[model samples]
Target: MNLFIGLLNMAIEKDNDRALYLVQKAEVLAEIELFYLLPHQRRWRSWFPEVIYCRVDVEKTRIYIKEAIKKGKWNMDDWPEMKHKILKLLSIDDAIIDLAV
Candidate 1:
């Protein structure tokens, strides 16, 4: 998770390649946890079903990447409009971030 956050920060800084690498790493980690680890952790299994968690993680990463890209393209003053536009176009619900953990 820390690595993913670092990658998100890097993406916000406009380091596209590094951000993509980090996103890929995050995806792999999600896959591992969903496919391998979680199955054995029955207590957690009810709350974090594999398919749902994996999809949510991927979606969150996508949203972070899109937001970072928009942030890079515009100055802070323009961010509100940019974020609004991107969110609208992407159809990304703000509620997803809260549910992502």
Candidate 2:
């Protein structure tokens, strides 16, 4: 609870109104995540603390990465490698194991 409050305070300080309001909502969710969910049973495992908790389908995650790369104007050919890194960040158990490094 304290951690969530502190995080909310920091977010509110640094972000704009919309982001601040979202952080307030996130704080409520964080409270539930921290107290209601047990350690092993928690979904997503706090994999990306900077990311808000939500249902992120693997395909959508891939698409988002591709879109972000395009937006950033980076010309990288390693689609497979980038996909693997995004999946790993999400802590998805089915992510390609051989790509681990």
**Where is the poorest 10-residue window by lDDT in model 1?**
47-56
Off by over 4 Å in 1: 1-16, 40-101
Q: Model 2: per-residue lDDT, tens digit, 37-88?
A: 7776556655425567455467876665555554653333457677566657
Collision count of model 2: 0
Which ranges in model 2 have alpha carbons more than 4 Å from their true place? 1-17, 43-50, 53-101
Question: Candidate 1's C-alpha lDDT?
Answer: 0.57
Q: Give candidate 2's error at residue 20 in angstroms.
A: 2.8
Candidate 1's residue-wise lDDT over 9-56, tens digit each?
Answer: 667577566546556666766665667675556347564455432233
TM-score of each predicted structure versus truth? 0.27, 0.27
Q: After superposition, how far is residue 96 of candidate 1 from its true place, in Å?
A: 24
Give each model's whole-structure lDDT. 0.57, 0.59
Model 2 worst lDDT window (10 residues): 92-101
